[model samples]
Every structure is written in C-alpha cells, then in structure tokens.
Target: MESAIKWTSNETVLGFGKDAIAFLDTKLFSKKSPCDKKMYEILIIEPFYGGSHKVLIDMLYKALEDEYSDSKICMVTMTAKKWHWRARTSALYLSQVIPKQHAFRVMFSSSVLNLGDLIALRNDLADVKKIVYFHENQLVYPVREKKDRDFQYGYNEIVTSMVADTVVFNSEFNRETFLKSIKAFFKVQPDFRPKGLEGEIRQKTRVLYFPVMYDVGSHSKDYESTLHIVWPHRWEHDKAPEDFMKVLRKLSEAHCDFTVSMVGEQFTDVSKAFKEAETSLFPHIRHWGFLPSRREYLDLLSRAHVAVSTAKHEFFGVAMMEAAFNKCLPLCPKRLVYPEIYPNECLYNDSEDLFTRLAAFSRNVSAIKEVVADVKLDFSKYSAVNLLPHYVSLFK
Candidate 1:
C-alpha cells in the first residue's frame, strides 16, 4: 500500500473558502482505495505550515509512517501568514471538511490552533483523542519595547491545553515559562479567574525535544585561511539581525579577514538591518537571502566553518543543530535555548562577548576548529531513529 498522500501544488494553499471546502470534501471523503490497509488513522493540524514548524511536522509525519506502517496520516494546514486570522478561523474550516464518518483514532495539533475553539464547533473531533504540541507559546514570546503583547493568543493556548488530552512542549524552558506566565496572566485578570488551571495543564505537559533531520558528517575541509561565518535563522526582529550586523560592523572596523553567509528564509517584511548590511558589509558577504533548494542550503552549511545565533527569542534551536550536524561550530548567546543545547565553551555571555569571540576567531580560525574538534554533540536524543518509538507510544 502507498504510504503517503500526494498533494497537488495548488492544494496546499487552500484556505477557509468555498473552493477549499469543496476540494477537501472530494479529496478526503470521495477516495476509496485498495491501498487502505492501515490499522488506524491520525489527523494532524498545523495552521502555520512553513519554516521550522513545517520542517518539524514533515519529520514527525515521516517518523509516524516509519513507526506505524499500518496507519494513515491526514493533514489540514495553511500558509504561515496572517497568523491571528489563521488561529481564529482554521478550526472552523477543519471542522467542516473532516468527515464525521472517518474514525480518526487520534488528532495531533500544533500550538497555532486553538483546540478549544474547534471543540466549541461540536465537530467530528468530539470523540477523537487530541494531543497539542507546543512549538512555541505566546505567553513567553518577546515583543518590541513599544508594542503590547497579544493576550488573546496566550489565552487561546491555555484554553487549548485545557481541551487537549495531552500537551507536549518542545523544550522544558518553553513549558516552564508558559506555565509561569499563565499564573502571572491570571493575577492581572479583573474577575472570575480559573483556579488551579495552571496546575492541571502542568500535570499533563511533557517536554519532547524537536527532532533534527540531518546526517552528521565529518568536518568540512578547512577553507585555507578564510573564516566563513553563517547565520541560519529567519530574517526577523526576534532573531536580532541588528545585533548580528553590529558584530559584523565591529569586525569590519578592526579589518578582520573573514566572510559571512546570511542564509535563512526571508519573509515579505524583512528586517531593515539586513538591507543596511547589504551595503555596509557587502564586501564580506558570500551568500545572502534564502536558498530555495534544500541541497543548496545543506551545501552552504557544509562549506561554512561557524554558525552563529543572536536570537532574542528561541524555544528550540533547530537551525543551529542542522548547521552543527553539517560540521559548523556554534557560537550563540548564553541565554534562551542556547545554553541548554550548547556547552559553555560554545556560548558567550553577551553581545560584546560574542563580538570579542568572533574577532579572536577571525584572527585565528585554527583555534576555533581545535576547540570544536574536541567536543562531540550528542544528537542521538533528537534523531528520528531514537525518538520515533516515543511518538508511537504516545499516538497509540
């Protein structure tokens, strides 16, 4: 029997519309096949299906197929844009499309959707055992100094936790901070605060690290005398591209002999800092913007010597791990998810420390290589081969 659902190019962009409903109804309900040999079916809901979330979902899907060969996986997703609209609306579309007759044994959802909102619709999901996976939560999400936090999004996560049979966070930091923030949020509520909700949610929450889907290889050949630094993170504010550029500026002032590759997904609204870097740091840049092909991205990682992250917010560092697997030594901030993933030698105390480390690295690339050569990152815990069994047990 065929193992996966082959989706057309256009089918992925189908949103909450008449055309989407019609297409989903036909694709899901009208199909009758001799290949229907699965023992059970699982439905996956990922409203923001792009970047890291998309990568994680794809890995999970592949793992599920490998672990449970006789199971079917159905997905309902949307592009990663207009997130507020996606969160409030995607559930309604899913409720309308997933047939009542289809006995889905389990429904796995990402934090992007509010499962409580879906349950309120009183759809086919009523009897289905639901699991909510938190890629990141809005409660602990950092915002710009002048901007106000969206309480609605955080509240939705809390409600979804209440609705789900089990809640899983990608990191212990994410789980603890979110649970702590819930208490803080309730304290400020005017009236009718739900008591012991945090405790209830905490009891069911488990920390499962995100899987890294890449093969570890021998370190890349030394690029003679060049120091190739790569920033493999989204071009956004939370990633703190401005800070990365500042480091480059300092390097340029000191006349450091090195090259940089600013490689990651660039959304419609890219940081102005990157635009400025294009002119000021153009001489030092090797590759810029997103590489459409995964082969090309991996190739870039293979050639790079160091991977750096100056993120203000990171629940889990997926890109960093990917680069490390490709033999790039990581130099990241000592806070957020970095400290947990990397050893003390791989981290810097602050941005100034990071700049100092980079400057020293530029002068002597061999020293950096020597340090990295001695350390071995235990990536097995996040590998699909090791983590798939746990997922299978959870799904069962």
Candidate 2:
C-alpha cells in the first residue's frame, strides 16, 4: 500500500503538534485508529551494536528492566560491522524496521546513527524525548593523515546532536573535544557553514561516564613472583599496538623478569605487531589472543600486576579501568583521556617514561606488588550502582 506521510524539512517534521496527530489519523491510519497499535514506553535504536556499544546497551537494558518491570521498551539494533555503511544508512534501514506503536516517551540511541534523518523519516519519534549518546566522536579521532578524515561522518554527528533533545558523552573529555572541534571541523567547507550551533547543542549536552560493574573477588598478591603485565585493548592501529610491542621488546632486551598477556578482541586481519612480538618476545608471553569467557578474562586481570594502554585514539579506556577494578595497576599515556580517568602516577609522558616506570617495577616486583595491595584506585563514579540511576532518569 502507498504511504501518505510527507514533510518538507526536519523542522516541519519536528514542528508537528496536535495537527500532525490529526493528519496521521486521516492519512496513514485511515482504516485503523492509533489505539489499535501496540504500545511501548521506550524505543532504542542502535545501528553499530558491537564491542563497547553492545556492552553499554546490554547493561542499560537490564538496568531499565530491573527498575521498571512494567515499562514496555522496544529496541532495534544491527550488528557492528561495516561501520561506515552503518553510519550512513542505518537510520533509513531502522526507520522501516521499527513498527508503528503508541507514542514513545523516550528514545535512547548512540551517536552512530543519523538522528536527524531518523526523526525526519519517523514522524512518531519527532516529539519523543530523543537522547543520543556519544561513545566516540569523529572530529578528533586520529587518522593516519588529516586528509583521510571523512567530513560526512563528523558532519552527521553534528546534525545528530542538533536533533537530539539530550546529547550525552561517556566522558567530559569526549564532550569538550567535540564541542571545541566544531568550528575547526567546519573550516573545510567552502561556503554556507552554520553559526551558533555549538552553543545550541551545548545546552542539551551532558557528560556521563560509561557504567561498568566490576564484580571481582579478592586475590592474594604474591610479592616474590615475576611481574605480570596485561595489554587489554583492541589489536588495531588506533590502539597503537606497535608502540606497545616496542616497549615490550625493550623490556626483553633489558632482561626484565616480566611476563605479558597480550589479550583482547581481534578482527580477521590481526595486527602484524602481534606476529612480530610472538617471535621476539616468545619467552615472555604467558597468554595471547582473545579469551572467549568473561570469567577467564577477569581472572587474568585479577592475577596480573599491571595493565597498559598505548592508544592514539581513545574516548574512554574500558579495558584499563576493568583491569584496575580487578586490582591491576594501570599504566596509560599522559595525553588523551588518561589524565581524566587515571592518576598522575599511573600516566606516562612518553615511551621512555613508560619503559622507565615498567623497568623500575620489574626490577623491584615485591615493592610494586605491595603498593598494588595497599593503594586502591577509586572508580566509584563509573560504577554501575552509582551511574545506573542517572541513565534510568534520562528516560523520564
């Protein structure tokens, strides 16, 4: 059957009020009334639903269900693959997939989707309290070369923020960097750039840390044993695996008594650094590759002495925090989000600085182990117990 919905612009769609409802009744629902449709209190749309995106949604779903047992929530999601394609077309695809239900009070989504286009396509969602969460922004995301940065992806994010009733970021750094880069990001445009958009979007912006539940059991730290280091991050170029491998090679050259667990998620084309590390640092590797079980992964972190991150692009470091929660000391770069999340003692300015810190710790394993046992990293703010309420409140 031919549909009857039509709109001139996003403004026209969102400007819809009582008249739009009457129009829907007359046009699209000529045969059936709005009351005949299934009702839902909440609607969630996630196009790139994988990795941290999946983890966050799963946590939020469980939290919402636990809090409001009677609330009917509907979610539409796609697997996290071909991210660029998902970003470009997910909104249109999801618009058709989502069924027409009774008016939704709240709509939650990540920044991956083109929210403006989604709202334009689905008139029912126009007046809903739309919330877009930014796990990462493309504006400052490091590319091999500045020229390689795709303008459309970043522009889509800016437009998404404009349409959302509430715009949220996983960290303050994530929020600030995106807002700061808006002007610079638009400089590439030849003409007809927007004005006052940054300020307009800022009013609805919020910084909420990604909620993590660290249910770790206490483990005895052995001071006499060799120091175990874990590098738990994606084996991707953005994570800077090459830099990490170089540091491990340095430790081996110095004859440092340490073992490494190079474990994290890996794609089909694994980083070449891992293959190189296998031959050079074979004696030092205790565990390598992705551990399918969460229990096994957490167990490895619990036993390890240190967790290190050498990331060129990180909005928030979940792996580092997880390791820290499991009693492992986190060693991260001073720049990016490390300063915002970890203490100065845990951050290193350069590879030499990281090597120096690791060399000292490796030489005196007993001393470092004692420090880890005594001093606990306070991650209370990011805990699911504390932040879940904030997330739940957003729906209302």
Candidate 3:
C-alpha cells in the first residue's frame, strides 16, 4: 500500500490519496474560525521532561494558562535519559504527532530539540516564531571523564540557537558561558568556519531566571532546636554528593548535635559515594532518598535550619532557591550560580571552609537562625507572577 502521508511546501497532508481522503477529511488542515483564531496557542517542546526541567516547564505552563485567558498551551515531552538521542529525534516525533489543525502562533522549545533540523524539515512550521529556552547548554556542561565527552550535543545546541527567533537562558552565567564556549568551538573547527553566528545568536539572547512557585508555608517559624541540615539535590556525580558526605563526616568527627536529610531523586547508575555515606552516616540521617510527596518535602525543608550544596556544576540553583524560600539558611560553595543568588556570608571558599561553617552552624544554631531571620532576601524576582509579563512580551 502506498503511504498516504505527503509533505507539501505549506502543510503536511496525512491520508492524501482519494481513497484515504474519504477516511481522513480536510478538517486536519482546515483553518479555524475568526473567534477561535483570536486565541493565541503556544506549543512547548521539552524533550527531557524530568527533574528541574519538568518542574520549570510545568510551572510556566500553569502560570500562562491561569494568567492569560486568551492563551492556549500544548506540550510534547520525553523522558530525561539518553539526552543526546532525545535531542536528535524528538522533533521528528513531535512533527508527526502534533495535529495540523492546531495553529500555533509560537513554538517554544528547550535546547534538547535540534531546532535547525526541525525547522528545516517542517516547512509548515516556517511561519511560526520559534523561541528556545536553555535550561542547560551542552557547550559548558561537565563530563565525568574526558573520553565520555561528545561535541555533537553542543553542536546541536549551537544549531538550535541559530534557528531560534529568540533564545532565553536561566541565568546570566549560563548565557555568558554558552556564548564564550561557542567562540572557542569556532576556533577549534577545521575549516570553512561560520563567522559571527555566536554574535548573531547572542544578539537575540536574553537572560531570564527560572520562575519558582513559593509554596513554603508559615511552618518555617518553628525551627527545631537541634541543627537539621538538608541536601536537596539529585544524587548524581555533577551534584558532588561525596563532598556533602565529607561534610557530614567532619560534623560526626566533631560530635556535633545535628541531623541530616539526604533527599533527592536517585537514578539507575547510583553513585558509590551515596552507598558509603549510607553505611557511615546512617546514625545522623533523619530522612533519605526522594520524599514521598510535596507536602512531606516542604515539611522537611521547613523543619530544617540549614540547606547545603556541594555541586560541581550548576546552571541555575532551583533546589537552593526552594530551600531558601522555605527559610533554610543556605550554605553553598562560592562557585557557579551560587555567588549570583546568595550573599557572601552564605558562600564558602573551599572544602575546609565549608566544613568549618557546617561545624559552626551545628555548634551555634542560634547564630545561623539570627542570620536567617535578619537577612531580608527578596525572592520576588524568581516568582512566576513577576516573570509572566517578560514571557508574554516575547510573543510580541
């Protein structure tokens, strides 16, 4: 049987033959009425939809849907594993699945989609404005080993940026690093190099912080007398769970009166450090692994007095922001996105510095509480309500 699917310059026609047309009517490609056309529909493509990435897009969707009565949103997402494969193939799947009748004014996608490839193939989507949001770019992403490094993912991001009408990054650091890395990538290219593509992409780029929904209740007022520390980050190599375990070990050696909640999602390839910590620091652990529910997670966060981070790479610190919103005193490394989000007092220079601060916090809980109480940190900027206008303006 001949395939009924046929690609045209303006539209993709499914079941195109005369016999197939009787089964599949023109309703597939027909335009909407004037009243229906008044509505602005957006198609969001997030290939890696898990963890922080999922949380971010979900929040954005909710904000837009609730706030703008005239706007409509549709999502096409994939699981967050084998990211390279996802980036390579998601667009092909999306093009086939998304209905032709749905007239999307804008197509919002993450860096996970090879936008250049997608846009080039889907002539029907040519008229639709494309906006690419970078939660994390492969250009500056860290690899555990040199041999595991593949430049194709980074190249895909570069192509994605070039094809996008506008590009948004979650942090200034992320934007700057991506821009700089692309320049270096160009320098290393063998021949027939493209000039000014980075600059062109940069000109269209904008920095917008991830919108955090403030759900932390007033329960934070009741801080436990005992020092309760929380490490709410994924148990992965990039998060550097070993450093966190080392801090716990130092606290244990000092015989500090503290309890730790080692909470975060665990993947198949478990970090050996976590196993070591499980055995060694079992006594101090109050809660371990991913919390059962959001309520339970927030309750744990509220009860805790300090939130710590020992990440080796972070484009944006959403976990840290959530902890801070819950009134947990942040004690993070001075590198990555921490310096931009946290005050100098909250940052530690080295592992020894982190150990000293953790020990001090445990010994003098009152001091840290005072710091948390006195610090008038404004998290309003990260609020979805505040960021919605900026997002809406992008469609203009």
Candidate 4:
C-alpha cells in the first residue's frame, strides 16, 4: 500500500485508508521500530507483554514506528526468577528490554509494586509521552479483595499508573475495577478531597483493544491432534483450574473420551488448586506442566481441539485469543472480558452453563470441531496495522 504525504501552506497532510491487510505475527513482533530517527520517544510500561498482549503492543509499536519516524518507542518490563511462566514468556515478546537505571529510580522503598515492570518500563520510557498499559491492578485484583500484603503493593500500582501521561486498558471492565479501588482507597483520607482524581484519570483512559494475531489468510487449515485440549495460561490463581477439572470429571463420567495438554508454567509453591485437580486429571492427561518453549507450546495449541478458561479474573483473555487463532474451540466462563472476547458466540451463564455446553460438545463432536474453523476476531481492529497511526498521533 502506497502512503501519501501532501504538503500545504500551513500543514502537511498524511493519507488515511490503505490496503486492507492483516499483518504477519513476525512483522508485528519484530523488535525494531519502522523508523530509525529519535527526536522524541513513546514509552510503554507494563509488567509483561510476551503473551498475547506483547504481540499486540509489538504490532502497535511497529505501526507507530512506521507513521512517526522522528519518535523513538520503548517498552519497559521487569523480570525476576520469582515471576510466573506467563510473565517470563510475555517479556520475550518485547523487541527490546528496559534499561536497569529506570527501575532502580522509580521505587521509593515505600511500597511493593505488584507485577510492575519497573526495569523495563524505566528503560523503554522516554521523557516525551509516558503511557502505562495496565493489564491488572494489584491494588484491586481479586487477591487484593481477600488480603493485604506485608507492604501494600496496591498503593504502588496506584502511584505508578498515576504518573503516566496516558493510561490504556485492554478492556472497560479493567478500567472500572481500578477506578473503584481508587475511589474506595481515597475515602480513608478525610482531609483529602480527591476532587479532580476521577476526571484526571478519565481523560487519560481510553479502551484500546489488545491487538491479536488472527491470520485467517494462511492459517493452518489443517490440524492433526488425536486427543488435544489446550491450557496455555499461567498455572496460578485467577484462572480456576478446579472449574475446568470439574467439567472434565463430568466428561469422564459420561465416557466422553478426550485428552488434555496443560501447557502453562507453574509458579512458586504448587497452587493447591492445581495440586488437587491433578488427581482427577491424571487419567486423561497427555501433556502436563509448563511447556519447554513458546514455539513448542504454540505448536500444541495448533493441534488442540478445544481451549477453555474458568478464570474469575481476566482483563482480556489473551490466551483464549491464541487458542482461537490456532483454531481451538474456546469454552470459557461467560463473564468479564470473556463476553467481549467472543460477543459473536452466545455467552454462557455460569459453570453449569459451561458444563452443559461441553456436554453437548462431547456428544456431538462435529459441533465442537466446527468452532476451530469458524473462529473469528473482527471486532478488535487495533492490530499493528490499524494502531500504528494512533501511536504516531499520540507522539505527534
């Protein structure tokens, strides 16, 4: 597609529409920006991006590079041995790593920042336009609702996100959750009015759907897995493995033959949920524990028959998108971003609803098989190609 740059007396005009083309994942994930110039910079700070969100940001950065050559784009991330597998994998998606100087300066030793990629964020960040793309707010996450840590990380999240010139959320649900937490926290300060906080945050926040790779063009039209089910998420809380196990148990009882590949990383101490579910799941297991490599894991996704998530907390279901892109029937608890993930498919009511869906799916194999072919993501238009201009405009 040819891009036109027309000059006028007062300003120069940039062309709008181009050839309608969906880009390759490699192009989006390529580390360098389109332009080599560095007059200004667009910096994004996030805990992890290597998962589906990393792909989205890579594509967005690539697009920004193409449109705004004068601007330098950076992404910051922080990784430790303690971080989960999903976080580790997401960091790999970044073309570049955040510098060390930035991370050390940001922490005041006052609060523990939950999942804040302080190092990467400090490095990728420029003095120009600082954007914080928050996936989950530790301050108000489900775990936060239950207990407070020794050092409150929630305060750290609030302050970090507050520092950003612009705040971007993957979904409306996440933005609302964060705001509610901020509002609740503010009430404790009787003298503090916090009058402009809501308005200030609102102006910065705009829902930018995560760019995903759904290559319908040369997508592998062929799949060959004898017994395949995929779980390409982190082996931790939020994503309820128990709900999935229960459904699988019913399938086993019904003599609905199947095998599963639990393809995610297990973090820290063995989660009780994963531990407890292991006994029931041992019978039908084909692949267990975290995968060896990202490609190998994605390869498994390609062959899987179905992908399901019983998570109570998902800002945006990136793993599900990977499954859908790889041609898997996504069976999820119809809540949070799940509804937005697949508005086309009728959202199931609850766990029982998912069980009913799976029951019918097992009985009529063809019905489940068809989802692999028909899976589509036309709603999320912010893929690298579409979002490039926006990134450029933000810097401009």
Q: Lowest summed-lDDT stretch of 10 residues in model 3?
A: 1-10
Clashes of each: 0, 0, 0, 11
- Stretches off by above 4 angstroms in model 3 are 1-40, 67-71, 144-148, 217-224, 267-269
lDDT of 2: 0.78
* lDDT: the better of candidates 1 and 4: 1
RMSD of 2: 10.4
Give one digit per residue, the lDDT tens place, for model 2 in 1-396: 122121111111111222322222221111232221457677776787667887777567656666654236666678777788889988888788676755578889999999989989998779989999999999998887778999999999999999999999999999999999999899989899888888999999999999876655246556578989999987877889889989988999999989999888874476566788787888998998888666667778878888999998888888888888777888889988879887776888999999998999898877766666665467788886688889999987
Candidates in descending TM-score order: 2, 1, 3, 4
Report the C-alpha lDDT of model 3 over 152-242, residue by residue, as the tens digit. 8888899889888899999998998899888777655778878787789999999999876566633654444878899998887778988
In model 1, the runs with Cα more than 4 Å from the true position are: 1-40, 67-71, 145-147, 216-219
Q: Per-residue CA lDDT of candidate 4, range 1-396, in tens?
A: 011111111212222222112232233332343222232234444343344444544455455555643134444433323433333333333323333223211111111232244434434433434556666655454554443432245555565566656676777887887776677665655675456566677778777666554433223423332445677777766677766788788878877767788877654577777777777778888788886555556667766777878887788776677677666777776677777667546367787787777666655556666655565655346354465556446455
Q: Please, what is the TM-score per model?
A: 0.87, 0.87, 0.84, 0.69
lDDT of each: 0.75, 0.78, 0.74, 0.55
lDDT of 1 at 258: 88
Q: Lowest summed-lDDT stretch of 10 residues in model 4? A: 1-10
Stretches of candidate 4 exceeding 4 Å from the true structure: 1-76, 80-127, 144-151, 187-193, 215-227, 267-276, 292-294, 344-346, 370-382
How many Å off is the CA of 216 in candidate 4? 7.6
Candidates by lDDT, descending order: 2, 1, 3, 4
Residues 1-396, candidate 1, lDDT per residue (tens digit)?
112232212223232222322322232221333222332377777787777777666556655665554237665567777667777777776666554556678988898888988888855677888999998888877776414777788889999999999999988888888888887777657789888888999989898888656543334648466889999988877789889988889999999888999988865576566788888999999998888666567778888889999988888888898888777889889898777778887888888898888888888888876878776688887765566567667788
Which candidate wins on lDDT? 2
